[model samples]
Target: MPNWGEWAALAGGVPVTEERDPARDAARIEQLDPAYHHHDPSVPERIWDWIGEQLDKALGSVGVPASGISTVLLFVLVLVVLAGLLWWRLGAPRRAAGRAVALFGSGGPAGADEHRAAAAGHAAAGRWTEAVREQLRALIRGLEERTLLDVRPGRTADEAAAEAGRVLPEHAEALRRAARTFDDVVYGEHTADAGAYQALLDLDRAVTASRPTLAGSTS
Candidate 1:
């Protein structure tokens, strides 16, 4: 009968005789560097390479020379960058205008007294648009003071007209027309005249004499 080692050898099993050498194994691993086996590029390099390949293919299809394609791409990139910057800058004024409309509707005056004074001053200067805007503000403020209309923050002229109209049904049409006039001057960029200013002034006076209706009653 064969010995265990001989039997194992005959069965094609090798005996574990050699001990693992940590330092030598590490050195061997370093010599056979795994990094060299990994042929894939880094993320940014891969992205740039992919973009270049796609660009080359596209330009080639259009019969554009590879040399000129780079210049065209650079020009397109510059245009994209400039467009982004322009949008960022010009967006501010529109946003500010929207914020102003939300905060004070057309524009803000200090108070009803200040608005009335400013309206008078504008009227004297023949700035009818400014006069009309200030007068409307004065009218809205007066209604707010009398508790005829609840104090609404960020109220537009149209909204004020509707609320005030519900309370003063007699002047509803006039109020709506006056509000439209104010909106036309402020937002529509239309010019105002003496007739428009006088109409707003008349509406302002009428609002002052108006009384609040019963709670939850349009009548």
Candidate 2:
């Protein structure tokens, strides 16, 4: 696997807390299949070599040994955090961006495109309630990403429509209707249908193509 440390090191180094241990790297490599740990300079070997070099450099910067298990663990945690931030930047769960606790009791996608994909998957599987919910999530996230609406954490579907309505008044009624559909499937425990999902999907496409009116301006 690539170390990914080179890119991570661009963030700069901190004080190292551990010393290099020769046996450590060998032990880790040993844990993997010997078929993959060979000395051949084949493509895979080259890739592994590059990863090793990058890791060594990053470890050197922070005075942490490449074999420093504790430092490696810390790097894993930092990587996870960076991943979460990237997810947020891409319009995923804004720490519950889709809304109330029940809105995401089973978790959700990590971005607008992802939500749309999930919605499609559900629709294909004949899961209309799930499809409607995910489609609406895509709409909300897409709006937020385009700056049509502020990225408000914990905002409900209705709040999202109401707020977005101020800027896209032409779509106000449609947005409200869409929000109600979302609330019905998500909170009202109502079942949805292909028609409902299609309606939300159509609205999502329309809103994506429609330009939001500038603040204090008329369309």
Candidate 3:
């Protein structure tokens, strides 16, 4: 096997001279033309080329295309403007309306609890008509909250009933009967008894049990 120096010399194309003189060799190297024979730094040329290639690949990987980025930014801006306009104009009323519609049919107030309270208040005041009216209103409001009807104060029980049957097939019968009973007590001059009150309570229970509970429901 050849020694390291022999191998290195052979690899480097160094001549195998009979006499090895360090100073002479140094002098001979120095005598060579500086313009034609230049010394390169130890770093390989392929290292620099590889670094540049890797940089290009890294940039391609890290950054999205300009066109794609522009399109995404435009879409975001449109959504922001639309949402801002809607909030400014309607003040979340449409969302509330939708939620109320989901909760009762019109999405007016929160739940049957509110109706029960209103009815109780009316009953305590000895206003049987108002109590009955409130009870019916509770039922209607429940439907409205459930998103079954578009509840307006001026809307009649008949109209609400029809809409309930159409919009909330599940709770239509309850709404219809409650509307009728309320109308009877309020307009038809029927005296509300314990049975009427119990009926209203029963209806209230049914509504609370059946309808989905709405968050942030308002009157």
Kindly report which residue stretches of model 2 are placed more than 4 angstroms away from their true locations once superposed.
1-106
User: Per-residue CA lDDT of candidate 3, range 1-219, in tens?
Assistant: 978988899999997666789999988887786754456433676686676466556555879554465465578789999999866544445334223222122443345458668778878877666666666667767767766566565566656766756644566687677666665554343577656776766766676566443445452
lDDT of 2 at 100: 49
Clashing pairs in 1: none
Off by over 4 Å in 3: 1-115, 124-127, 211-219
Cα lDDT listed for each candidate: 0.79, 0.79, 0.63
Candidate 1, 93-165: lDDT as tens digits: 5434344353145456757777888898999999988898888888888888788888887887878889999
Report the Cα lDDT for residue 153, model 2: 68
C-alpha displacement of 51 in model 2, angstroms? Answer: 85
lDDT computed for candidate 3: 0.63
Residue 143's lDDT in candidate 2: 89
TM-score: which candidate is best?
2
lDDT of 1: 0.79
Query: Which has the higher TM-score value, candidate number 1 or candidate number 3?
Result: 1
**In the order shown, what is each candidate's alpha-carbon RMSD?**
16.6, 23.6, 20.8
Decreasing TM-score order of the candidates:
2, 1, 3
